[model samples]
Target: MSIEFIYPEFEVIRNESRCIACRVCERQCANEVHSYDPERGIMVADESKCVNCHRCVALCPTRALKIVKSDCALRENANWPQSTINEIYKQASSGGVLLSSMGNPNPLPVYWDKILINASQVTNPSIDPLREPMETKVCLGKKKQEIRRDENGKLVCEMTPQLELSVPIMFSAMSYGSISYNAHASLARAATELGILYNTGEGGLHEDFYVYGANTIVQVASGRFGVHKDYLEAAAAVEIKMGQGAKPGIGGHLPGAKIVGDVSRTRMIPEGTDAISPAPHHDIYSIEDLRQLVYSLKEATEYKKPVIVKVAAVHNIAAIASGIARSGADIISIDGFRGGTGAAPTRIRNNVGIPIELALASVDQRLREEGIRDNVSLVVGGSIRSSADVVKAVALGADACYIGTAALIALGCHLCRTCHSGKCNWGIATQRPDLVKRLNPDIGSKRLINLVRAWQHEIKELMGGMGINSIEALRGNRLMLRGVGLNEKELQILGISHAGE
Candidate 1:
């Protein structure tokens, strides 16, 4: 028995008086929500088909279109909301696990909003960034314990392979199969221009991007997609993808529909085949096994590039990171629960991992307690929204932060949460030729560069206000942060005190 239990989620409104039947909306929308009706000589819409990406609304030549959430509601019940009931109904019909895109949209506690930053007052006058020399440059890798002098009395400066960034922000991993080639090109160009790095997300580096290897971080996941000796050696650094924030314990699944053309070649997989990365690396059964892989990668790269171990933030993340720090990895990247992805199971994305703020604080404290904080650099990410979030993250103890969702937004993502549909109208997340062409790499790269450059200025201004001149000075300075509306337990977990304390 079929049931019509719910109304359309989004309603489209068109002003007939203002509309001229130009049909620009029809051409721009990839979801086919609008169609021209020759019989009525007017444009018509199917509201049920709309994801409310605002593509049609943005491209409407007559400025007569708008999308709004439908006001219709189910019987008011706090115990079971409409979304919960809808998911149950959907699963009953489809008999498959519900899939969601991007980050968790549930109303969870956002620690970043609850935490606050402190500025210098008359006691310690704030430095003006314009007149003072403020440095945002950061290096990601292990640092020497102490300076050593040779027998000739000359200093011996020995350091591990490090990735130098002009800013403390980098574009997080977004695979070519999940996003488009134009999107990858934009990140590559932006990273090059910004003197930062962009990750490949285990999809393997495209041949065209080899020239940007200086600003690239190639990833090797359980799938071992597009992995080769040359691929390992081509990048500034290599990352082992142990887990992802969106699907903490789950593996990656690139559907057959998206595995075509260059995607198949880059992934080193057959066309029209699903690329499934197993939950755990087959060869890794313990921490020692992880150490083996880390050293193997170092050997394969001829000890020239740093090896990073990335794991999702979880309950025992501090212990996990502690083990990884001693496992020969030069850097550790921790991802939080709110991290974005092209597709993830709804259950895992919403309920699996902890917040990055808590994880970063715990890991930093543990590493410091163990006296191994300098063994590896900590790069934190999941949802680093702005320069303020970056400042907060560094104060909470992150050498650098990754910006995934923000980078996508810079490339015109409307966050419709329909990236899994493979019909991204903005051309940032789709592989369809028509949709892909909508994004010009040249313009996209410039926009990305502009975003990072603006953020660098803001970061400098924030640092200046704190009376800090360099990122190294601000790296683990938790004293510059205070908590608001957070309980003692929350503040303790974040290693910060309540505001006005």
Candidate 2:
């Protein structure tokens, strides 16, 4: 055996007693892991290609197939883990940067898990969500600091454009090319039905999805691909994606193989050509430069659509967000280091940015200190796993939360972390026609709706337990949060006290 031959990470186990040899697994697996061994008169698997996506197991009529992590190990070393050793071996052979999909799998501290929400005890009583009203609805945009009266003593009701969400959650950006057309269709349909919004990543809005424009936030990234006046005007809002949490400083890259037909036409790029976004927007070098483009987009959209500046949560994110707020952006979306992406360099994805909890709290405190808290709305993302995370984020000062990985999971993604390969077995991240057809938008959208609605109900219940009947009251209410296992510094940055105190 070649010394360089690393064992396959997963093993496919077939139960001979239950095996019908129907070849259903072979036909369903896009990775071609299963095949019929005609001579042996049984179906066999080449486990090397298995991503452990569970597609075959789900489709097997006899339930004979199962994929399990191989119990393979090397000399265990704390300084050099098995995955690290294997990565070195693979990189030595491939001579290329390692890529990964989905969110960081590193064992970093999740602040949401460490923080506990406060519930009513004596003075303030908890409200029953079923018996009383609870408001999860949120509006994302600039807010007036004070009410002004006209000469006739009438209040000024004029305000800038805002995104009205039925729940304090919106589906984050997942470009069409990075995902499947049916996946985008599912998100668009679910967002519209739920009275929220979905971002059209850097990929241009597909012509077919123009009908869902009311629930869309078209993005303008460094590449500015597929962006035009019509594209900007077709959405409820516009997002300038300065950076993403997964690959903070670097831009995006969609392999040419995935860019075919509508993906090419929508991105306005030639077919079979790599779509590489520049690291920085050549037109934006400073905050002043960003302000110019922000105003320009507003002008092009006739000042009707709200402009959002989405940035990764980095070391100086508080200062960066303060600048964005002053740059006339109606909203600032912060993505933490754990955020998901279609693909990102493994090193950057694991080690670049800060947690969204720290970033959101610091930015909110900074804005409030500067008396510009109401200037622009705050939205945070990067691994908002459940309704509890949503509630904690609001208490940490986020006006709303953007969910990407969670939304994709609702549409049948197994988090195999192989999306960059463009051969998703679940039909959520592939461009192949055969694979794409596996996901029915009708079913996908319905599942997404169910997931979000369930979260909304939970959000209301959490709020009711806090004696807070509205999300607006929960916003920036750090007093309602307390840390459990966090250190003093983390607790300070998160603007919360210890659980006991």
lDDT of 1 at 340: 99
Cα displacement (Å) at residue 176, model 2:
0.8
**Worst lDDT window (10 residues) for model 2?**
1-10
Model 1 Cα lDDT, one tens digit per residue, 267-358 = 99999999999999999988899999999999999899999999999999999999999999999999999999999999999999999999
Please write out the lDDT profile of model 2 over residues 358-400, one tens digit for every residue.
9999999999999999999999999999999999999999999
Note the residue pairs that clash in candidate 2.
none
TM-score of every candidate relative to the true structure? 0.99, 0.99
The numbered model that scores best in lDDT is 2
Whole-structure CA lDDT of model 1: 0.94
lDDT of 1 at 33: 86
Give the clashing residue pairs of candidate 1, or none: none
